[model samples]
Target: MTPPLALYIHLPWCRRKCPYCDFNSYPAPAAIPEARYLAALFADLDADCAFLINHRPLSPLQSIFIGGGTPNLFSPAAIAQLLNGIRQRLPCSAAIEITLEMNPGASVMAQLPAYLAAGVTRLSFGGQSFSIRSLKQLGRIHRPRHVLAAVRAAQAAGCRQINVDLMYGLPLQTLAAARADVERLLDLSPSHVSYYQLTLEPNTPFAQSPPPLPAADVSADMGEQGQQLLAAAGLQRYEISAYSRKEAQCRHNLNYWTFGDYLGIGAGAHGKLSTVSGGQVARVIRLAKWPQPTAYLAAHQSGHSQIAHQRELSAADLTLEFALNALRLTAGVDVTLFQQRTGLAAEHLSAARAGAQAAGLLDGGAAGRLVATARGLECLNDLLQHFDLS
Candidate 1:
């Protein structure tokens, strides 16, 4: 059977870049070329779909995610045009979950109804923190009041599945402050919550001139407390940084964590696809579009290839990549999924699995699943080292 497929549409323009964000995002110009960009996006998607159809059977798209610097910055008419074009080109599942990432700084309230009408079923708000001090430190443009207003607007728009992205372990963040942020988010009764620990990524401004971060122990305590608070509010921790109500998990991201196939379109988007070659051999291919918006559009207009990079994964590469994603899930994936996704036999992982289990990093349950122990989840880097195919 062909693996489930998803679509990721990246919007690389944000009002301003955050100090800690290392994503391929840039500040928008005075005017966004929405029409031309939408045309380029469909052209990029066409190329990817052609490649997939030639290599393997095309599965109905299970989900579509519109994410980026701030997709909410675009007008709803643009979003509607994009979504309509997507449906016209691809065979989308009847029950596909479509998500659009929004930021409070943008006037999301005015666009929520149009977005819903355009087939967006989920709204993910980028509300990093409720504390004004932390928001300023992070260079976020939105105030706490904006976050509240956006959530209220989404709720009033009859959006049932809402996700608020919150960050802990900010510069000079205290446990009390972190808990307060979680408490404020819980009050909104969002269907999903992404509580992330702030990390200084390489090449980011924060990495070059680091802020005064909390101590390691303090950060850990804040995470534990926040998780406890979320659990108390009936949100289950399904993945490392994600919590959701029952059946409310982000399907697009879940597909990613499970090593399912997805086609990525837009500037700096990355994609992974699996195909069976030579009758019995399975090959996994990685593709990435041009990183710059101007370059991507130029390539699209010229009918030139938008993919800046493409490579087929070796057996070892597939094994390591599969483990890298699957182990991030709290419940983990079935042992058979390793083979189904990677085309590698379970025996290929026996030695590493045994070593990890012996080291108390993996659970040795008889349920035919590969699960990480609490210790493994805490020391995830150490556990992943055991599966290093290199």
Candidate 2:
């Protein structure tokens, strides 16, 4: 049997491009072309469904993650249309998790009720910080009050699963300021929190002219202190950057961590799927759509495949890819999961596992669990080197 499946939809329009973001998002125009985008997305979904029918039938979708360039820019009607179209094309559980990402502000809060009514089960806000200066430095347009109001609006709309995103290690950040952000986020009483450290990703404005952020040790301290604060508030760390209350983990991301298959739709979405033939794993395919919205739309209108890239994972590739995502979980995955997901024998990891064990990077040695030591989690890139074949 195939692993669990999920669906990912990308909306690549934001009100304004942040200085530090590296996602495939563009600034919104005065009026977004919602109808055209909706049509294209539906067409894309139809094509993928047809393709799946010829290859392998999918299991019920476990979750749907509508991520973006601030997906809140779309009207609730458009979202409803999108979700309805998906259910018509693909089979999914009635209780499948549906998450929408948005920036916290008054502009979008008024529509939260309609959005919840449209089938969004979870709301993830880009509540980057609570400090006025931090918001300005991070190039976020929403005020701190806006974050509070957004959460309140979601709750008033009867949204039960709310996630607040927080960040540490800002340019010239102090330990106290970082703690304040965590405190304010916990005060919102969200079901989940994504606490991240600011990094100057390559090709972003921050990378070209990097700001003076907290030093390495200070940034480490900031993360450590923030996790302690979150645990105290009953939101323990789950994934590397994710903390959540009991039974409230983001199911869509959990699918990714467990190396499950998923379909991708809309601009710049990526997907991984395993094809089975004769009751055996035949091949695992990775596919990505064109990143540019204009180009993607034109390709769709012309009835062309908008996929910009596709590749099959080699045995070595599968070994590393599985470890890359699974090791991110604090508790790790069962040792047998490597073979279950990749179709290769679990022993493919034996040599690399020995190397990691000798280096004190992997714990639960030679057992059912494949956990990373605290030091291994800190130097995850280094730990991944053991799995690297090229």
Candidate 3:
């Protein structure tokens, strides 16, 4: 059986890049070419669909995620046009979950209703933090009030599932300050909360001139405190950085963690699909579009290839990739999925699992499932390193 499919649409323009962000996002121009960009997106999607048609059957879309610099930067009408075009061209599930990422600074209050009407069932706000000092230090444009206003607007527009992104480790964040931020976010009554630690990613400004972050132990305490606070508020930790009320988990991300297939359209987007080659050997293919908007648009407009990169995963590559995503979940995946998604025998992971379990990192119970111990979750990178097939 073909795996469930999801769609990821990237919008590469942000008003400003954050100091710690290394995503493929650039500053927006005074006037965004919405029409031309939309046309390029559809063309890119069409090419991918055609390729799949010749190679493998396309699965019905289980979810759609419009992510990026800030998807809310586009006008509601532009967003509506894009979604409608996608629906016209793709076979989507009846209960498909559509999500749009919005920034509080982008006057999103006025666009919430239009987004909801455009079939966007979920809204993920990039609030980052509720502390003014932290926001400024992080080079965010929005104030704390803007976050509250945006959430209220989304709620008023009848959006039932909302997510607020929060970060715990800041340049000068105190334990109390981190707790306060979580409390403020909980007060908004968001269905989902993505609380993550701030890491100084390479190639970003923060890495060059490292900020004075809290000590390692202090940062760990902050994370623990935030998790406990959210737990008390009835939000369960579904993933390393994600907490949500019952049935409010982000399906788009869940699809990714479980190794489901997805088609990605837009500049710098990545996609994965599983297919059978040689009539019997199962293979997984990875596709990526051009990283720059101009190049991507030009390729599509000139009827040239939009793909910047494409590769079929080797057995070793597939094994490593599968473990990299699956082990991040608090509730690990069924062991059967290892073969189903990677086209490898279950024995492929036996040695790695045994080593991890012996080291007290992975749980030894759940004979048919792969579950991570609390130690495994904390030292995820170390646990995953043992799975290296090279």
Tens digit per residue, CA lDDT, model 2, 283-305 = 88898999999999999889899
Clashing residue pairs, backbone N/CA/C < 3 A, model 1: none
Per-candidate clashes come to 0, 0, 0
lDDT of 1: 0.92
Off by over 4 Å in 3: 277-281
Question: lDDT of model 1 at residue 272?
Answer: 91
Candidate 2 wrong stretches, greater than 4 Å: none
Query: Model 3 Cα displacement at 245 (Å)?
Result: 0.4
Question: In candidate 3, what are the lDDT values of residues 56-109, reduced to their tens digit?
Answer: 676689999999988988988999999999988889999999999999964688
RMSD of every candidate to native, in Å, equals 1.3, 1.1, 1.3
The best-first sequence of candidates by lDDT reads: 1, 3, 2
Clashing pairs in 2: none
- Candidate 1 vs 3: which has more lDDT: 1
Report clash pairs, candidate 3.
none
Model 2 residue 131 lDDT? 92
Better of 2 and 3 by lDDT: 3
